[model samples]
Target: MSKLVNKSQCVVICCFPANYTVGLTTVVEALALGIPLICTKNVQMPMDIDHEHCGITVEPGDMGGWEKAVNYIAENPDVASDMGRRGRELAEKVYNLDNCAKDVSAVLKTLIKK
Candidate 1:
């Protein structure tokens, strides 16, 4: 899954009707790989996908919106590439393991101090 996702141009996470917190790992992988995404809005991290223009989000169960978003990305290669670059930047700055560890350490230290 990781190799396939890393090699893909874009990833579509269609977690509709059953919103589990499953697709976030895929999302992070896609971000790290600089791939654009099309995802259901009910996923655990819609803000991360939408805020950075890393992808398009459609309401869960909205097939038409999904199709439109896919088509838009397909038709706009430049925009898609830019989104991918932004996603990579976001992944490095926010989602990298080093940053995550730092964040955790900070919280733990604060808790210990308190």
Candidate 2:
């Protein structure tokens, strides 16, 4: 999976625009492997895929939007590569396992204290 993701130009996540699954680990996994992304709106968050330049987001059923996004990546290979690099950096520096573990531990400690 890592190899495939890294080799790919981009990853496309097809989900309902309103389906709020932003915290899905798959997004992190893809980013960690340095793959650019194109996903439905609301599929990812915290990292702000679009704003962070890690990916593009489109409305759920918007085929035209999908085409434009795909074309953008295809037409601009350098930009796509940059997006992947940014995604990898974001994953490593912010969404790494160590950070997640620490966050979970903090919450657990708080619950225990309560």
Candidate 3:
């Protein structure tokens, strides 16, 4: 999956609300691979893809919106590249394992002190 995503221009993760578990495995994978994303707004996401400037969201079941999104990425190379870069930066900030361990230890230490 990582290899495939690394080679992808962008990733589209369109799904219905409650169609499956709203895990961010695919999303984080795309971010880690530095690929821009087009996902459904139905997703129960932890972060704002739009606010993060990592991707755009489409209304669920909107075929025209999907078409527009793909065209936007294909036609706007600079913007797409920026989005991918931002995605990678966000993944590094939020998902780096070493940073995660440090954050967890801080919380644990605080609890221990309490």
Candidate 4:
């Protein structure tokens, strides 16, 4: 899946059971690879995509909305590319391991000081 995702133009993450939140790893990988995404709204990282304008989100179980989002991306290559770029930027800013570790270390230090 990693290899395939790396080479893909876009990724679609469909969460099952309508309300379950999953697929964070796939979302991270897609963002790291600068691939635009079409994702179900119930997934764990919908806000990451929405706030960053990194992808299109559809309500879970809404097949029509999903299809429409996919078609919109397919027809608008430049828009899709921009979304991919934004996704990569968001990933670097928010999900980078070094930055995350630094944030955790800061919190721990504050707690220890108190």
Decide which is better by TM-score, 2 or 3. 2
lDDT by residue (tens digit), candidate 1, 46-87: 355787899998888888998899999989989999999999
lDDT of 4 by residue, 20-114 (tens): 35877788878889999998776445455766889988887898998899999999989999999999898898878997789889999999999
Clashing pairs in 1: none
Using alpha carbons, what is the TM-score of model 1? 0.78
The sequence of per-residue lDDT tens digits that candidate 2 reaches over residues 30-112 is 78888889987883356668888898988879999999999999999999999999999999999898999999999999999
**Model 2: number of clashes?**
0
Candidate models: Cα lDDT each: 0.84, 0.84, 0.86, 0.83
Candidate 1 has an lDDT of 0.84
TM-score (C-alpha) between model 3 and the true structure: 0.79
Q: Which residue segments of model 4 deviate by more than 4 Å? A: 1-3, 17-21, 43-46, 102-114
Which scores higher on TM-score, 1 or 4?
1
Error of 3 at 4 (Å): 3.2
- Worst 10 contiguous positions by lDDT, candidate 4: 42-51
Which regions of candidate 1 fall more than 4 Å away from where they truly are? 1-4, 17-20, 103-114
